[model samples]
Each structure stands twice: as C-alpha cells, then as structure tokens.
Target chain A: MTDNEQRMARAGDYVLGLMSEEERDRAEHDMERDAAFRDAVLTAAQHFHKLDLTTAPEPVPDQLWQKVSERIASLPQMQAAETAPASPSKPRVAANARPKRFGLHSLGGRGGFAIAASLAAACAIGYFGALATVTNPQPVVVVVLDTPANTPGAIFEAFADDSVRIVPLEEFTVPAGQTMQVWTLYDKAVGPVSLGTIGAKATEVRLQGPHLPLPKPEQLYEITLEPSPGSPTGKPTGPILVKGFARQPARS
Target chain B: MDATSDDDLCTALLVRVARGDRASLGELFAREAGRLIAVARRILRRSDLAEEAVQDAFVAVWQRASTYDGARGSARAWLTTIVRNRALNMLRDGARLDYVDDDMLEHFGERSADAEAAYAALPDREALKQCLGQLDASRRRSILLAYVVGFTHGEIAADLKAPVGTVKAWIRRGMIALQECLS
Candidate 1:
C-alpha cells in the first residue's frame, strides 16, 4: 500500500491480539514473510521479556484455585474414559489409562462423582453401544468431542444445553481458509447439530437447546472444519476433526 | 532477584512444571504472583484487574506446561509474555479492566534463588536495567513503573501526576530508546 501506512505498522500496534475476526483473515489472505515485521516482533518481545515476576504476589483466591484444580482433576479422568479403547476396527494403543496406572472405575467422575459428561465415553466406544447398553435404557450413542490433538472439549450433558468448551492442545492454528465447527448426532436426528466456531484457545459455546433442555448423557458429539463463516450444508461436510462419546456419572 | 535472575528462576520452575509436578507449580505461583500483580495493577491502574491478569496467566502456565520451549527464552520471559498478552486482550475488550472479587488472595513471594545464580554471569545484562535508569527522573520513573509493572500509559500519567499525552510520549520514547539500548 502507501509508504505512510507501512510506517504505522513499523511502530507495531501496541494492541494485543493484533488480529480480530476480520483483521486476522485479511492479514492471512495474502500474507508474506517480511523481515521487518519479524525484527519488530523480536524487538518488542525482548522488551516484553524483561518484565519481572520475582515477586509473583500472594496466591490467587482459594476459590479460583479450587475451580482450576477441580477442572484439572476432572479433565484427566474424563479424558481417559473418552480415550478408552474403541472397537477393534480402529484398534490403537489405549491412551485412556489412569494418570500413571490402571483403574477403570473412578469415584469423582472417574471413580464415582456420577460422571456428568460422558459424551466421549460413547464416542470412544463408537458403535459399541452393546457394551454401554444399560438394561433400563433406550440405546444411546456416545461421542467424545475432541480436538485433532485428542483433548476433550466438552461432554454434552444434554443436547439442549448446547453447552460446550473447546479444550485446547497448545494454541491451535486455524488456517486462513477454514473454521472449526461442533456437531452432535442422535439416532433419529438428520445429522450433527452445529455448536459454532471457537478461537485457538479455550472458548465458551453458546447452546441453543431451543428444542432440548440439555444433551442427554451418551449422546454423540463431533467437531469438523468448515468454510470461513461455516458450512452451508448445515452438517459436517469436511473430514470429522474430532468425535467422541459422552459419559456422565449418574446423579445420586 | 533482579530481572535477569528472575528469568532464571522461571526456567527452573518451568522444568518442574513440565514434569506434571503440581506442588512446584504452586510454589512458583506463590513466589511470582505478587510482582506480576503489582505490575498488572499499575498497567491496568486498578489493583483488582491486575490480579485477575496474574491469576489467568498462572492457570494457563499450569495447563500448557508442555508447550514451553526453553530454547526460545527464559521461563520468566515466556510467562511475562503470557501475562502481558492476556492483560492486553482484556484491555482491548474495553471491559471494566478493574479487578473485582471477594477475598481475592493476592500472590506473594521473593526473587528466586536461581535468579541470583543467573544474575552473577550476566554481562551487559544490566544494559536494559541501566538504560531504564538513564531517563529523566520523572520520565524514567513512569516508564519503569509501566514497563516493569505493566502500567498503561494512562495509569502511569495518573501515578506521576502528568497528562496522558505526556505519559504516552514518555513510554513511546522510552520504549524506542530502550529498544535502541538493547540492540
């Protein structure tokens, strides 16, 4: 563009998260490797590097720490169940084993906190409905909604809540052309329900459970790559990026 | 305990974190949180807001421990980058940018023992610290408060009892000058 416009960039916008939804797209549209930009970032990063954390401060609130710990503790167990062995057709090493040992049943979600989100449980056992088949229940299909990295994003407590979280594996890089979309499958339903797109890091999904109050346990969940805005087909047309079963501990 | 040594301490803590050791992570948090909060408080110019920035930063470090690459920079450098980016994201949203919570525990701790070791061999390490010392007393103070503390230009202006525009100029100039010195 103009020489003047280049200068402002030379100064680098002090603004963090330099690209917004649109800006990011535009920047990537015809992105090129520029040494000047690289130098500027390096320079800025060095200065940023100097900020001291010698005095990290007092511990954060116990509540926040508690919330984080709970989230972390539940995550490994939930991740394991979703990662449990799938059918022999897709036989791979079982990655869902406990933290360092073995124990299928857990008390808190894993052991017994009535695992609330078992979507991955269903997905992991894909087509193994018989294994998950409970005598009192109608047939249920579970889907472990995960990223390409196999990190569990959400366990659909119910399709109605439409609730979901994009669990990250490092900061994911979404290429310029495609966006991530979440979907769900029910036996009678036409196809996966769109949960919407998310950022590279964790993002909260707004559920539109207009029809259902929340996704029932054992429902199938999946994420797929679609066009910039999203898929016009209204169903996942691209390769299914992540799919999983839902297993939630029964409410006692 | 100075910035150089601080970076060293961060690296040691990160090594422990990568091993999935929660206790060491907590220890690191206990040591670095306050300074992080203090800088954040200055940058946001609101104590509560700054504290949130620090908390989010630490939580992320715990979750993404595997991604930290020591080859790129020190642990302190990597972490400061995380904290700064998160804080800036919050600012960009133009939210209240003020900390708010009941009985929010502030982080506290001292310069790391590792930092002391790193500090010993630092040649021209003081270049950055010394450059910061050279600014006009007021300009230098404002820049240091903002640079080290993460205070925004506006917050620095208020703290130094100067105009926002003036604070902005000092930061811009200070950073530019600081850049020159570092290079």
Candidate 2:
C-alpha cells in the first residue's frame, strides 16, 4: 500500500482499537509528529463516534457524580495555555525537541569515565542543584541512559535507600496495556532486576526499588517496554528502549 | 436542546471547567454522564464497571480540560473518547475480566451482539452509517466489533471464525475504504 494509504489504515486501526499495545504506542507517538496522521485519526474517531451517540443513556447513579467530584476535589487542572502565554505551542515544541545528545567521544562503552563532561553538561545544572538542597539522601550513583539512536533518553539517580529518581529527557509513550520497566544489572548471575514500572507520561519521579547491594559504578541501567504490571518472566524480556552504565557522583 | 447546541454548551462548560470551575464540571456531568455510562456499559457489559469508567473519565476531564482543543472535535466527541478509552482499558486488563471458569464462548457471542447492535442503531441519516454500509460484510463486522465493543484483532478473528491475519487485513482495508467513503 502507498504510504498515505498505510497511514490511513493505521489510523483506522487506532480508531477501531484493532492495534496491539505496541502498535498503539507507535501510532500515538506518530500522531504527535505527523499532522496528516493525526487529522486522519481524529476524523475517523469523530465519524465512528456516531455509534457512541446511539447508545441509550443509562441511569447514572447519584453516587457516581459525588464520587467523581470527591476524586477531583484535590486534583488541579493543568493550565498549560494560561501558564505559558508566550509559548502557545510549548507541548508541540517539547514533543518535537530531539533528545539531547551528550558528548560521549572520550567515554568508551561501560566505563566510569569520570563525572566531568557529560554529567555537568546534561544534568548538573538543574537536578544536581535542586537535589542538593532537598532533604532526600544523596544518590550513590547516577546513570545517563542513551537511546539506541545514541541520544540521551533519561537520567537515573540511585540513592543509598534503594530509591531511584528518573528524569526522562524524551516523552516515551506507554499505551494503556503496556508499561515502562526500569532495570539494573547489579549482578550478572542475578540478571536484570526491575526497579519498577512507570506509566505513559514520563516525568522526573522517584521509584523505591527492591533492596539490593548499594548501586556501584558501571552498573547497567536500562528501561524496557513490557506488558502492564511488569515482565512476566521477572527478567528483562522486552526490547530495551534505552540503556546506560552507572557513574559514582563526585563527592562535594 | 438540539445536538449541535448541546455540544456547544458542553464546549462552553468545558472552557469554564478548564478555569477551575467545579460547578461547570457538575453541569457537564449532569448532562453527559447518563449517556457516557451507557456507552461504557456497551463495552464493559457491567453497570458498576461502566460507572467506574465514567467517574474516572470525569476526573480526567476535570484535570485535563485545559488541553481540550475544540478545533480537533466536538466536546461531546472528546468526552465520549475519554470514556471509551477508559472502558477499553478496563476491558483489556485480564485481571478484571477473570475468564477462568466463565463460558468464554458465551461471552464472545454477547460482545459480538453488542457490537452489531451499536452499528444497527446508528441513524440512517448519518454519513457514518452510509460509509460503513459500503464495506463488505466481513469488513464491516470486523470494524464494528473492534470499534463499538473494543475487540482486538484476535477477538474479532475468533468471533468471525477467520484466521487472525485475515481479520487484520479485513479491518485495515475496511477502515481505509470507510474513510474514503466518508471523506
């Protein structure tokens, strides 16, 4: 099929819920980047929505509304438009921004490579300064995972307390039935253990991982796409989206 | 009120909801919740789960109303999409379904019936009805099963007694043709 035909077909699959979890993720990611595909999906979705309207209204329980109101009572609306008046297309811009590539010229594969150039350039400016002032214990080691395409995907700060803070540089789309699983190869014999899983929208967040020996230098850190809940095999089975080697943060 | 004006009112109320107005959300809920619950019920086939889906959707609508761009679609469509997505997710989560001892064949039969019932209910005047009518029966059934009832390719294959690959092709080609006719 022609490219446009294929795109329209995929859009239909998306609208019809026929795509697999991974295919849905790719389609959603494409929707952000491809205007035509987005338009196609939206149009198809709207058209098929006529069927939704035909559904006879069911009796909504009085408590349902009350429950919804209570649930959202503490939640705040994300005021994206009002907050960023000058940057009307801020989300679009962020979506389009390529993952930052750090200068890895001198750093060879799986080496400590001192926390000098890339760390300072990529992370130190914001996270280091902010984290230093916070009451949270200092991270034992930091890792900058690179996408297979060699662009920095996320930053991981492993702490002494078995908590890891993840700062994703790129917006990885995790559709409903899938999750992003974080893993570390602390021991080759033990294999890669899951730190935890995160939902679709990735942001700077801390995850309390399983108790293991203090994370050391050059430990493998990676994130993979897995079935919801986690990898069934309890090992890294899915395709790794990003991977990196750990580096001990220089003591202040 | 007519559908267009009802949709317009929803858009206006959603704009207020985006500005942190709780009353507007309540209004939208009063207006759309019943219909949304019914829509979710078609996919979930359980009133309690349907209610849960609509409740979650309302919370999401409250939290993410600011992101709603009316230029993309109608407020009603947006609301329906959110509820449908939530219901589909709940349906896909195997733990919730727990098909262990239940008659899997009977469940599939009922879901397929729900899917067809939805398509048959579409208004005769709707372009969607016309476009869907143009597709072959297999194509049309596959598309309906997927959209109206959240059937995966595998489920549709099982329902139609066709190979998975064949069901996938039917849906892809069917959707392409449906869009062409709609456009």
Shares of reference contacts reproduced by the candidates, in order, are: 0.14, 0.53
- Residue-wise lDDT of candidate 1 within A1-252, one digit each (tens)? 244335223333332233343443233221223435434444555554444433335435556556545555566643665577742321111232211111222222222211211321222110011011111111122344675667764533331112343343334456778777666665554667666655333343333222222344566777677776777887788776667767643211
Query: Scored by Cα lDDT, where does model 1 land?
Result: 0.48
| Count: clashes, candidate 2 | 0
Model 2 agreement with the true structure over B15-101: per-residue lDDT tens digits: 556555678889999999999999888888789889998998888777556445555777788888878877887888888788632
Off by over 4 Å in 1: A1-40, A47-56, A59-64, A74-78, A81-252, B1-9, B15-24, B44-51, B91-94, B97-125, B136-142, B145-170
Top model by TM-score, which number?
Answer: 2
lDDT of each: 0.48, 0.74
DockQ for all models, in order? 0.10, 0.20
TM-score of 2: 0.59
Per-residue lDDT of model 2, residues A84-144, tens digit only? 5552211111221112112231233223122222232232111111111102234567999
Q: Where is model 2 more than 4 Å wrong at Cα?
A: A76-252, B99-104
User: Global CA lDDT of candidate 2, please?
Assistant: 0.74
